[model samples]
Target: MTTDLEFVDTQVHYWQPSANDWYPTLRSRPALYRDILPGDFPPVAGHVHVSAVTAPRAFLDETRWLDRMRHDTGLPTAIVGTIDPAASFEMIEADLLAQAESPAFRGIRVFSGLDPAADTTLELFRLLAEHDWIFDLIARLADVASYLPVIEKSPGTTFVLEHAGWPDGEEPGQFRQWREGIARLAAFENIDCKISGLGMALGTMDPQRLRPWVETCLELFGVDRCFFGSNFPVDSVAGTYAELITAYREITAPLSEGDRHKVFAANARRRYRLPG
Candidate 1:
């Protein structure tokens, strides 16, 4: 089973405590309260540097910084910058365009500052599609259904669901609710889900326990629409990099070599338009 499925992680974050912003959440978490950069990442063939929280004014700056980091390291081959979608429409537009100026800029991930149901949010989603940028949504399980209309309206925009809708835990009720929400999202052809970051739900990384959730996502989205993401540093609390990769490989081993390759690498490279 050692066929060539070059690893291209779709979710990795490069960050450090800046003078004005320390990524408060990371600072609070013992395992992630430090600097992480391309050098810190495992030797994957490529990766997409998802945005780490930055000060409101620093959004475009962080994008520039990431572009420079990619230039120097030849790593994080794709970059998903951040934008303050809560800002005025003009501001968000300016922020998105400024971020887009970076050669590697691919899209954005918002931890907050988005109300997909709002008029402004809907407009922003449309803008993403116009520019061919990604909306790496980070929604909680309870809020999944709320974004359906926005997603439905923005047909061309690629909406990537983060962390399997950020499952709170794997309790029976929780799993059912999350599964239902994901099923609804999968109905839209433009939506894709990341089968990463479930470690937070389990408290520890156990492939056996995570199998059902991983299988469910593939069953819903199909391998073509899904991507492999390590969610490093954050998932570091639950398991080592090697263990996480091994776990995913084992969980998806039943698929044919081409299908497994789609989940582990091809899908992301094609979705993100990453150059080799």
Candidate 2:
């Protein structure tokens, strides 16, 4: 099954003792407490890490910690660091510029799911544009309407919508909302979507159950605008690493080999500016 197709798991996270208090369940399990180092990943060419949603105020500290861990353990091909969109544009821009010095710092993430209508988010988008940093927008499907105005305002910034806009469960109306919202968001050239985190968002242990949302994301974002991600640790709650990748493969099988490669690696490389 070995083709020349190298993979880069673009959406995993590594946790530390500082994150323990936020996720008490994860802290209780020593087996799960181990940091997701490079060795824990499948034999891939590289990986990119998205910051976990703990300690929102300490984003810079988290980035420093992750950078140290990446240097010490050789984990993560790159990082999507967190920024509170509520911060002033000057502060956010300064923080982003500082993080850009780190080789592992690839982009910035703002969890739109937390506060759908946070007014400061528009400023955050402007900061992303000023620094030429990618913005990982984490919003619930229902929140997509709230983000549309901001997305429209920041046309120059590259936006990666996480979890297919974090679609709701299998309810027909919820699904329709997600589908329509994504199509609307897709109209913005700056926006792309990652086909990850569905299992976690759906709270399902079965990856097969995520087929509909995954299919819808591909249909909306298309291969060029979409990329695959493991969303590990978070996704580990739903299924194992192998299971996650296998599920992605099963869902993307209808696409051509080149398109699959884009989803698996090329799109991520381009999005994060990873070296080939």
Candidate 3:
């Protein structure tokens, strides 16, 4: 790694349990069906594990598992837990309180199918703001623009878009739509882009080919609002973990050392409130 190396990988998943127990949907993606623990990654100063499965009862349990891992193994300096936006507020609050007990708990990430403009969603944003916890937003690229209204209204909430807004692909039409939606979301000072998980849909792992997407994000969100998240074993579909890091390093090489540092580690430290 170069000087000011970003040792904090903001997005890493420790895949545990069998496909049936951890995430049944993962069975379709054999690369991610197996266990991917912290030991699997290259050495890093810190890691943040986003929730993969968000079943209500299992949600807090998963954070607890991660907390235990951090204490025992000493990676993932922080944890971004999960919440079921669809669940009743009382139940969600209980789970959140339980999760907050862990010092590593930073916030929760809710997945797609959320109505960006729905009252429920707005209320969820407010709930997160009350805790000053990070709100990890996941939406389909096609539907990304639909979220503009709600995010605009919830200025107090800290929003982090997951997987480049989950672009389904980079074809002309999809690329145009993804870029437009991402630009729109980037307009909000409250939001940050988690530059992770793109390998799931993208075909090649070459840094030059991938540079366009990464550059587009840097251009739109600026380096301060963008950070590296390997998305680990899941994103290994794009390339091996080492290859993914190499590609990011290659793509971001043009940045100044400080800006480069922010993309790799510093920004996540600020956004997730991780200690130095």
Superposed model 3: Cα runs more than 4 Å off:
1-4, 18-20, 54-56
Per-residue lDDT, model 2, residue 81, is 84
lDDT of 1 by residue, 1-276 (tens): 132557888989888774436366666676676778888876887888888875556767777777777778887798888777668989889988898888888898887767777899888888989999998988777787788888888999998988877777778998898888899988999988887888866766788988888999999999899978888878887888888888888898899999988888888888888986
Q: Write the per-residue lDDT of candidate 3 for residues 58-169, one digit (tens) a residue.
A: 6677777888888899867888887776777777787788999999898888764566777877887888899998888886766766877788789999999888777777
Per-model C-alpha RMSD:
1.9, 3.0, 2.0
Model 1 off-target regions past 4 Å?
1-4, 18-22
Write one digit per residue (lDDT tens) for candidate 2, span 30-109.
Answer: 76666655566677767788877455566677677778877887767788987666667577677887777788887877
Ranking by lDDT: 1, 3, 2
Error of 3 at 130 (Å): 1.5
Candidate 2 has a TM-score of 0.86
lDDT at position 20, candidate 2: 39
Residue 176 CA displacement from its true place in model 2, Å: 1.9
lDDT of 1 at 171: 86
Worst 10 residues of 2 by lDDT: 17-26
Q: How accurate locally is residue 103 in candidate 3, as Cα lDDT from 0 to 100?
A: 93
- In candidate 2, the residue pairs with backbone N, CA or C atoms under 3 Å apart (3 or more residues apart, or in different chains) clash, namely none
Per-prediction TM-score = 0.95, 0.86, 0.93
